[model samples]
Target: MSNNLKKNAISLPGAIAMSIAIMAPAAGMMFVPQVVAQYAGSSVPLVYFIALIGSLFVANTIVQFAKRITHAGSFFAYNSAGLGQTMGFLSGWLLMSGYFVFYPQNILVASFFSSQIITQHLGINIHWSLFSIFFIVIIWYLSTRGISSSMKADLYFVGAEMLIILIVVFAIVLQGGADGHTFEVMTAKGSPSGWSGIFFGMIFAMMTFMGFESAATVAEETSDPKKNIPRAIWGSVVGMGLFYIIVTYSMSIGFGSQNGDEFAKSILAMDYLASTYVGDWLRIAVAIAGIVSAFAISLALNNAAVRVIYTMGREKVFPSKLGITHKKYATPVHAINAVGILTTIIALLMGFIFGPYPVGYGMLGSFGTLPILLLYVLASISLIMFIRKNHRDEFSLWSHGIAPIIGALVMLLPIYGSIFPFPSWPYNLVLTLVLVYILVGFILGLVLKRKTQNLVQDVNKIISSDGSEKL
Candidate 1:
């Protein structure tokens, strides 16, 4: 590696902002609540509750590694430290795939919301592809600037999104809800589809927690990384968890139990709720929040994907040029550009081949979910192994062992649900495609291990570095 990222460029709040942005609480409320309600019925809150618990366990497992091994590679470095170099590379590749897949989905979301807002308010009809390309270009520019700049933008966008959500949530509560709040929504008896539907709903429920671990990816850029990164990871889960539960509950009550079918059928449930409880103006605000949330996540995920590639490149697992940072900005310019261009190409291709809505919003969204859950399982396993073998003196049975095991097991539920039910054409195909991608990565890892002498040592040296070296 010949270039270094700026050290101490991000603070605790900045890191936390990025993590929350990546989670995209506003977007989750919009996209996930209706679908979850369709399956889990009034038990939507409970589904989010279960997902929150799983996210906490996974966050704790990640904290275990973040506090010990501070690296920009995040899951890549953590798995390498806990497992071996090969597994680490595989984890990185899988994690990268997750981000790559999600990038287009975010673009699609931005395009969709932007189109909706313009067509509804401005009375102008524009194709979503134009807005998608515009947003993608904006994301590319922001991400390539530097970590500090990108995260600062994240703070603004995420703060606005959260503010809108909170406004609508409080409005629902103060209005006493359409049917009044009750604990019945938390029980399986309230579910229209019963327990089976609740289990199926868990798959999407867990997906809302997808980017909570994102702070760890910026460990190298954060101030006091060993301390801040762990806090950001755990704080993200707690913050977003509370946000999801409250919004979901308010939505459940606001829409009223009698209107379950209406809530399920509505394309933008939260926006409809906002229009009913607050005002039609709040619908526009929610739409704006959706657009901002999508843009913020795209920026955050791009930042994360590039760092993983930069780390791998540094270790010679990828092209060495990808390891180079911008001389002035100290950002991973090469890797960022590569990811941006590739993401744009994929987004355009998918839009052309399958249309923006189906491919961008549907297929790409499903493509990322399974790999992320798998990565969570692998990271948890790596934590368990690392603690047992290396950090036995400091390890606690709960945080180091039991928590990760529970995390791995809880994550499996979603993975199983995603596959066993065998979703319709495109979604079912995503599972097979993700497996094929990982298989290819595993083969590549094996080849790299055989060809690159001292590959493990290089990875170790890079992860263990103190930010003074190029790494």
Candidate 2:
């Protein structure tokens, strides 16, 4: 590792900003509003609220973990410190699995936008899978250069995306007032299914909010880790949550359940919402912004995944070659390449199986959510255990103890809904991916454990022979 490169690379604000932007894409109006509305009906905003509260609890646990022990591996290291080596390895593997699967998932979103925009405007039909592969390759190359550059690009993309979403929200609210509605589909009283539906709907809402805890993965390179990690976690929680509620509220009014036929036209929901309330030009702009958000997310995921691999390699859990830092680029070249190649292959395979464009994307997005949730469950448990054992002074019984236990149960509700019964096609696909990841991770962790054990034994022998051991 180049000490100078690491020192010069990241700042507290920059890291926080990067995390916010990366997370911001998941809360895009076009993304969250429709999904929430699908399950919760007029009560979509409540789902966002429920998920936000769950996220805040999870965020607190993560923040406490980050404050004490800063590492690039993030939740993996936290669980390891709190639980033990085997659980830590499992956490790291789960995180790695999510990061790897999620890269292709985001690219699928970008490709959907790319294909939709082109076919709609130019009336051109292109090979979406091939085009998506090309798009992923370009991002992989750019990411191999440096995370700083990737984040710099994200600054622009995230900004444009947020601006467009804000405009759409404003237009929707204005139209709602004109149509004589208060835009408070948020009323808990009217919802027939009530909080039951809201909680159920929140499973998907929480899926969209997966990347916030990811900020901790950058701690090794982030300046002022203590302040920035906490700020990034809380700031993202509030910012993304507010955005989700506002956008969903606007969409509910725009949807206007008054006319059954018109309201059911939620398939082209964003297009209809924008054209009806905003304008055709504004709709075009929002579509463009959605595309940019997808690209920025893809770049950010690539940056995070490569760093996780590098961290694991340095600890001798993964191959050491991935730990090599490039002298010129100050990036993890091998790790970056590994992510790129794997994602490209997965994208190709998925494209073949699912057909092209939007369908493939829906599958990837759904499949990717399961493993990410599993990782969160592990992290939440690790926080409770770690605080109870290591930092008993900093945390009390409720914050570290009861909160995490409840948090874990809450997190699992979504995972259980996803796997055993399989709610939807996307849910089923995601469950399969999660199972595959666990099976592979179990085998790999065993091999790594043996290798690590040998290294520990050698070190112990050296210390004992040198008479440097207290025992």
**Candidate closest to the true structure, highest TM-score:** 1
Q: What does the lDDT read for residue 97 in candidate 2?
A: 72
* TM-score on alpha carbons, each prediction: 0.95, 0.89
Model 1 over residues 234-352: C-alpha lDDT tens digits? 88999889989999888888877666667778888888888988899888888899889988888888888899888888667899899899887888889988998898888888877
lDDT of 1: 0.83
Best by lDDT: 1
Q: Which regions of candidate 1 are displaced past 4 Å? A: 450-455, 458-471
| Colliding residue pairs in candidate 2 | 367-430
| lDDT of candidate 2 over 1-471, digit per residue (tens) | 542225436665557556666665533456655655655677677777777777877887888776676667787677766666666777788887767766787677677677878998999987667668888888877876777777778777777788777777788787663345653566653244666656666666776677888778777667677678788877878888788878766766666633322343365566667777777887787777777777777787887788788877766778887877788887778888888889888877877787544567666666666667777778788887766665567677777877777777777777665554556666565666668878887777666775444333432343234322211
Minimum summed lDDT over a 10-residue window in model 2 is located at 462-471
Per-candidate RMSD vs. true structure?
A: 2.1, 4.6
